[model samples]
Target chain A: DVKVTQSSRYLVKRTGEKVFLECVQDMDHENMFWYRQDPGLGLRLIYFSYDVKMKEKGDIPEGYSVSREKKERFSLILESASTNQTSMYLCASSLRQGNQPQHFGDGTRLSIL
Target chain B: SQQGEEDPQALSIQEGENATMNCSYKTSINNLQWYRQNSGRGLVHLILIRSNEREKHSGRLRVTLDTSKKSSSLLITASRAADTASYFCAPYALYNFNKFYFGSGTKLNVKP
Candidate 1:
């Protein structure tokens, strides 16, 4: 079975503070993604990395960035956390091939006060 | 822009009954996938149906796809308490399979 682990399950930060959410996947998948889920809006993609050091912006990439320094780890960075950024953040990983199902970690619920 | 949209935003059914959810997409797709998310948890991939295929099943879950209408339906037979969760559908575009677009899922509650 594939396992994806997020560093934190619940997080709280003050406004303007920088926040970091870490994710690690044991399966060494080539594709990693970061998304923020809000009520009634479903999951909104923030950023995704197809390979180490390569990142692409998704639909809702503003106010957020990502880092993929290694194949097994992907990081989501909130440059300047605002109240609007408070939401459940999910990390997922999948193989590079098409039609592959993504494995997800138990999301990090972020609270920006 | 969102590609898939699920209808009947919420559903409530008694245990042992069947629950059905529908998803509609805007463009042609290579394949469509379904996922379920328990409260406060990340989504768990349920099933995937390709465009060429009309129907697929896994355990008690049955998924049917209609390419002409760009719609799909998921039927859960003999619903259990554990089956209560928010269900989402992701439609992968024909040319962009890597970029996934998910809609506001259908929330199903099963009464014991």
Candidate 2:
């Protein structure tokens, strides 16, 4: 079985604070992704990394960035947390191609006040 | 932009009934996958169907894809209360490496 783990399950931050969400996968998958889930918007991709030090912006990358210093770990960073940034953040990992199913970690529910 | 859209945003059914959900994609895809998420939890992969394949099944779940129509359907037979969750369909385009666009998802509520 594949295991994807997130650093935090729930977090609360004040406005203008910096937030970091960490994710790790045991499967050594080559691709990792970060997404934010909203009520009507579904899962909108924030950022994705295909390999170490390689990152790409997804549809809604604004106010968010990602890091992939190693194959097993991916981190999402919020430059300045805002109330609008509060959301359920999910991390996923897949093989080289998108055709393969992605394994997800238990999401982190972030609340900004 | 969202590449996939699921029909009937919400569904309510009783236990032992069969539930069906539909998904349509805007562009050509390498594959389509179904995932389920309980409230406030992470998503769990349910099934995957390639563009060339038409039908696939796992347990009581059946999935069918029609490339020409750019549509797919998922049927869950004898649904139980445990099947209550939000179901999403994601389509992967060949041009994007390891990136999948997800649908709004169908909320399934099964009553015992």
Candidate 3:
């Protein structure tokens, strides 16, 4: 079975703080993604990495960035956390392309005050 | 913006009844996938149907896709209380590798 693990299950941060969410996958998948899920808004992609050092912006990448220094780890960084950034963050990994099903890690529920 | 939109934001059904959800997308897709997420948990992949395929089944779950209309339907037979969750449909475009646009999801509640 494939396992995707997130660094934190819940986090609370003050406004204007820097936040980092880490994700690691044991399957060595080539694609990693970061998304923020909100009620009525759905899961909007923030950023994605296809390979080490290669990153692509999704529909909603503002105020957020991603790092993929290694194949197994992907990190999401918030430049300046704001109250609006609070939501359920999810990390997912897939074998190669979109055709394959993505395995997700337990989401990190971030609350910004 | 959400690429896929599911019909019926919420649904309630008896335990032994079957539940069906529909999803519609705006663009052409390489494949359509269904996912289930329990309250406060990560999503679990339920099934995947490619554009060329019309219908697929796994266990008691059935998925049907219509690329011509850019829509798909998922049916859960004999739903139990445990089947209650939010179901999302994700459409993957051909040009975007590993980038999927997800629906808002349909929250289903199976009554015991």
Candidate 3 on A1-113: residue-level lDDT in tens? 99999999999999999999999999989999999999998898999999999999999999998899999999999999999999999999998856899999999999999
Better of 2 and 3 by TM-score: 2
Name the 10 consecutive residues with the lowest summed lDDT in model 1 chain A: A95-104
Residue-by-residue lDDT tens digits, candidate 1, A1-113: 99999999999999999899999999989999998999988899999899999999999999998999999999999999999999999999999875788899999999999
Residue B51 CA displacement from its true place in model 2, Å: 1.3
Off by over 4 Å in 3: none
Q: Could you tell me every candidate's TM-score relative to the true structure?
A: 0.98, 0.97, 0.97
* Cα displacement (Å) at residue B10, model 2: 0.5
Q: In model 1, which regions exceed 4 Å deviation?
A: none
Pairs with backbone N, CA or C atoms under 3 Å apart (clashes), candidate 2:
none
Chain B of candidate 1 vs. true chain B, TM: 0.96
What's the true lDDT of residue B8 in model 2?
A: 81
- Stretch of 10 with least lDDT, candidate 3 chain B: B1-10
Model 3: lDDT of residue B1: 33
Candidate 2 residue spans exceeding 4 A from truth: none
Q: Candidate 1: how many backbone clashes?
A: 0
- The residue-by-residue lDDT of candidate 3 on B1-112, one tens digit each, is 3278998899999999999999998878888899999999989999989889999999999999998898999999999999999999988887776788887899999999
